[model samples]
Target: MDALLERIQSPAHLRQLSPASLQGLAVELRERLIETVSKTGGHFSSNLGTVELTIALHYVFNTPEDRLIWDVGHQTYAHKILTGRNLRMGSLRQQGGLSGFPRREESIYDAFGTAHSSTSISAALGMAVAAQLTGSQRKAVAIIGDGALTAGMAYEALNNAGASNCDVLVILNDNDMSISPPVGALNQYLAELMSGRFYAQAKKIGERVLRNAPPLFALARHIEQQTQTLIQSNTIFEKLGFTYTGPIDGHDVDGLVATLEKISKAKGPQFLHVVTRKGKGYEKAEIDPVTYHGPPKFNPSLGVVGAASSKVTFTHVFGQWLCDMAAKDPRVIGITPAMREGSGMVEFSQRFPNRYHDVGIAEQHAVTFAAGLACEGLKPVVAIYSTFLQRAYDQLIHDVALQNLPVVFALDRAGLVGADGPTHAGMFDIAFTRCIPNMSVACPADENECRQLLSSAYAQDHPVTVRYPRGAGAGVVVEKSLTPLPLGQAKIVREGEGLAILCFGPLLYEALKVAEPLNATVVNMRWAKPLDLKILQEIAQSHDRLVTLEDGTRMGGAGSAVLEALQDMGISRQVLIMGFEDQFTEHGDPGLLMQQYGLTASGIQQRIEALWPVAQVTSALRRVV
Candidate 1:
């Protein structure tokens, strides 16, 4: 670490560094980020892209004092490095270490905890309002990506803030790619505007000239504004009543700092559109950023460690299932809220381009869009992450569940996501989705089970959600076929004696291990919603102790479903619900996180040993039998 890096032990120390030194710090931070992330193989391009912008923000503004809200927080590694986490960079995403995203508890500099896309503007605006109401002199700055900016909530926030005259800064980091290649004409135009430097320089000169001179300058500025208003097509931000500034170069640290310093004191709802490269520094990442966006572990010196298609992921299973299902069913249509690649709908998009809908960072809109499509008799499969599905709760409840629409929600990354932290973890999907009236929830044990459950969900007309975890399964050889499993049925994977370990999703392995010492029976009750009564009754009658396990919260999860079932039946079954408690799972390796949360095979084994006495032997079995 250099002097600049050494000085930044915390955000308070950042104020000590000069602008030029801060710029140097940004370079070193980027080098550090690249070095660390390249080896760790996590969020390389996003962090590299935001280096200068991160430095400029800290240099121009008072962070921690001034609330800095980062939307879709993949771009926050630079901010983290600058905000006294420089030494802790190596501890990122590790167990008992730092997180990859902005956590409110992690640092005072991160004003809001963010993981989902398209939320910063609204959150920042709320903070701005709160600050004003509380008579605090803190400024609210929402650093959002171009992709996140496309969401309707950002526009809504812009509209409200513009009208309220809130002194909030909306920095649009346009990278031409948001995880994957950006779609729509607005993205293309922004790319064209940012690639060339002349436009920004000329605009800066015009602005400076307008600021210095008097009546004539004001008149010219007015005319210039009028001309821009007339000539330029109404971009999304401008339409929402924001004072649009730039398609500026985000990489130019000095230029950005100066512009921000100028914008910092400016009036209400300012939108600074800064264009950045996705993988700014590293050559390999710059060339192919999509691959490097959220790469797995690799050697920093060797670029990427293995070929992109070295092995199959659970996403691969979903992708194959999607294509196969589409081929089989004419009504099948695929939908993604700007997660075409992540959700494994790329082939579906290609094969059925007309049937495919990439709704661009709008989860609510996507859910409602699918609801509409379902009403028209199309089997709309909205493949989204469990974390992102939280954004469309009302739509999922009101639009689909009430009406009983046939929307198949393929929920990817349904459990504890590694590295991305609490924001990215899909732990709450079960708790939230279970309460809804007509929605059926499905959890698959492995890749094969995931495809089958997806197929089953597709066949249903009552709005089903099939959730699966990230990465590869237990290397189970999945059938190159789409076979719909029996809905609301639990499959008995094992039949033992002393204990019964009932589980949903990927935690079935953990439950199996916990059951091993107790000589327990293991049941993979694939569906959470229906709460397979047959299996529940059988286990209740036969087993002494029934332990429920899931990768979600214990409150309203798979275990909760079993308890609800027992309540309805009026039978007191010894159901010990074991899952992640009300607490949030932090950023770490999924295995380590699972272990920490007692969702690991070993962790479950220990917990079961302690809590295994929930069951009681019958008096008749002891005496008469």
Candidate 2:
């Protein structure tokens, strides 16, 4: 049979399909998603859960004109497939291929670019307001997951959205899970609301009797109101000024289509709660969604196979260090913003459940919460991604750094995170963190250094952050002992003449590669802040040319800090800075990105040869011959 999905080039075509045919299309879509993701290795469980919802949205709503915003767009693979990109499913997340998230440039249907969570409501509200002002009949809808609602921004938008007169439909796709199991009051409230028999009975009984008798319906409504008064007051959404609907089965395509058909015609702010199961169709994924949340390339029939590696990742080093530190120091505590597994804190969390805190998707709260713990004489270690840390910049500066609290931030995924792309990339941390007062930042070059730096940060009385890259470091033997490195120091890795490369973080390994070919000096500048002045000064004085290298952004990065130090010492040495360029980096293989950005050994060597005219001429002449 020719699949109905192939005919759905756009939402316009989707509107042509019969209601029963939409169900078959959904089956084909789910199978397509499972097969495509198994080969491509993209987001799995979330996409599976949103299959019917995505189909229903495009089928009922006039997309491209009527803006449909998806929060934390990992589940938009089905949306992409339905909206004319079905054939290109094979190239998902590849270089120059379709992005994992919704991009405004990619299609007219993608009204807004969204990779971060909790912004869909605000973006949709703005679009709704714009439509109202322009007198357009076009509607705006925000499809947000229950997990994304954990952040305060979602509520702030909800508070404003509920009060406004704009036309917008806020569909709450409740799967009872975010990336990690959702925590806090919101999850509890939704759980209570979903399971409460009083509300369920009232809804069922009130609607049945009202339809049966239109004349006595007004009196029946009064009785239903009396029954409601006996229970709790109106729902949280009702207070926020949104007309509430559902707790509907999201997998039921016909029900979803019918409900959305009505909501599309309604005016003002409307809220619809749809219940879904993560990894809905796939059996293995249904049993263990977390394992299937994001799996590597695998055979779908056999399920995801585990691949073993001997290399110890930097995240693993921090996780082990956290356990060791907690064991030695009774005051040691660990915290993650709903990323216990991703941050490599699963074992620590299992071992020390009391000492571990997972503050669900709230980075700002996590930072301030850590600050509160530090005030009471307990040492708190915040394990967060570098990109996510941007969300808590104000909290870090105001609550932690301002008070000089002894909070150790073990920043995992500190550089170019691979397939997840720019949205997940940890490019701006060095620039942002280094500027904060009373904040000390260290970048480790290897697994051994990562462990030592973590120990060093924990030893400090003030705020200290140990920033390391995503995966395993340069295959170095990490010692079991917990020893602190001297703060604000640099290690002279190699010695040569004429040229010097002062490298920061894991890029030191690449620097060593380039330095060996040129006989250039290499200094592993471990600390980004409190720049290793003594060693930098000596290198500047001796070497005819100096180069500063970092894996972070070129603008106001670690290399820029080195430039400021040289200027302070009144040195007029010729210097070249190398790092990520001004534009946002695209998603691809991490090694390919590094090579393209000129961070690899050969790339760095070529850049150095460009600076040294004699070497450049010799290289060019040799190539010609």
Candidate 3:
């Protein structure tokens, strides 16, 4: 069975296998995926679900020639394995290793690089149109999850694709899950489509009538088509001009292959709805798909064990703050674009279900919706990932900031996100948000500061975003009280001579580590937008040189704010701006990435030493004395 998998190098080889052999191959592929992901700690349940679908698609389609775009690309582990990357699975999501999501740079089979959701249909449609224009026989396919269908972008693409009359296949992989269990009317519509009695009966009647009638094969097919059209004429996909087919079993390899083969030969836009269990083959994943969705490296037999950590994550701090603040204020409402568990709002949703809204992967709508809530005198706290917030920039500027709505944005994952890579990194939020006219950006230093900043952001009248990193900060005790910190004030953590380090966000600790050795002063610049000019000027007057440290991009970031302020104040001091360079960060361990990018303590020290040597610092200290 293992040899069967090893022999197949690409989809070309996969196509060579007989239809009966594919079932065995799918099993082997699932086993290989589970084994690899168990050790690598990448996406789990989603990958398991797509094993058969991936195999069947690759087997049926002339891939590389025919484009296949996967929406939210996390379920491409099996796709990667089949696309000649099986041997490299050990290094999945590691530094310079295979990406957790589909990446065009990694393989030719990857039609489009996608970590974000609801993008596949648009990309696939573009490819399909291009192929049609070039007079190419190549087909385009977009395998989008049911969860992705919630976003308005998917519908926009569908509307266009249907009208274009191009030969494109859009397979809706309905697993009834997308990170958190999918919500909204779309999910309900899909469920209704799957279980509707009339449609099911009509399909059954067509199949039964067609059975044992080889002589009337053409007649039987026509009857089935007519029966399906009568029943499914009102379907959303059909209405959009797509020839909608199936609520078929996604795990049935032969069935999938047969359906795909038929669709491949047909013309015009096609929509195939395939129902799949999120964790089909693996029992542990199948039982609890959510926990296994993106688990850490775990023992396959024992499964993902919940080990309590002493350090409190910034997300937990925000969750706790949201709950506490909601308890105090009746106007408080929590909003997330389908990230309940990811944003640590699970407790808040449970406690205040009415006030909590998971808008389902629709970032633009989430922002505008929060703005509407704010207009109606409700304090809408949009708990969103910094990366996801980019999707709603127009909404943020027009709906929220332009109106100066008091919507508190709790931006989780505000820096290099490690394994998820550049596509998911929240490095540009500070830069982007600061430039927006009426928006305020807060960068918390630690766990306690994160809670305080959330409170502070909530208390503000205008739109404010409190940005924090992915995991736990420096284990500072988070205070229980909903005390708002003084807005836009910089806190002096340590006072020294010669040089001063203006640190933004959690990088304050890294600056502190190098402060003592370099005889430097450390100032925690809490707010990126409303810079504390008073404290900045004071620090500049006292120190010989200044350094601005942030976890975001160097261009137009928190450091840039400091520089612009200094220039306006006419303070001519030699300053070093430190942050992420103009490049997409790679997938790896966060600490290692920090070191590589010279964001760690030792790395900071080295960068500082290179600019102003130990001798220069000593001389400056002597002059100060």
Q: What is the C-alpha RMSD of each candidate to the true structure, in Å?
A: 3.0, 3.6, 2.7
Give the winner by lDDT: 3
Off by over 4 Å in 3: 197-233, 617-625
TM-scores of the candidates in the order shown: 0.92, 0.97, 0.96
The CA lDDT of each predicted structure is 0.82, 0.89, 0.91
Please report the TM-score between candidate 2 and the true structure: 0.97
Error of 2 at 573 (Å): 0.7
Weakest 10 consecutive residues of candidate 1 by summed lDDT: 616-625
Tell me the lDDT of model 3 at 166.
Answer: 95
Off by over 4 Å in 1: 10-23, 185-219, 222-226, 233-239, 307-311, 514-516, 612-625
lDDT of 1 by residue, 1-625 (tens): 7767877776668767777686677778878888788656577888889889988888778877998999878789888887878777788778777777788888888888777777898898999888889988889999988488668887777778778777888998888787656776667677655544564467667878777778878887677677655555456667677877787878998889888999998977888988789888888889988888888877767777666665678899999888888888888888898888898888888999988888788899999999999899889989899999999999999999999998998889988888777777888998899889898999999988888898889878799998898888777778876668988999898888857889898888767765667677999999898888987887777776678888888988888888888778766756678888888777777876777777787877777767544454432211111
In the predicted model 3, the residue pairs found to clash are none
Q: What is the lDDT for 313 in model 2?
A: 92
State, as a TM-score between 0 and 1, how close model 3 is to the true structure.
0.96
As for lDDT, the candidate ahead, 2 or 3, is: 3
lDDT (Cα, tens digit) per residue for candidate 2, span 193-312? 786545765677778867878878877778877866566456799899999886888999998999899998998999999899999999998888888887888899899877667788
lDDT of 3: 0.91
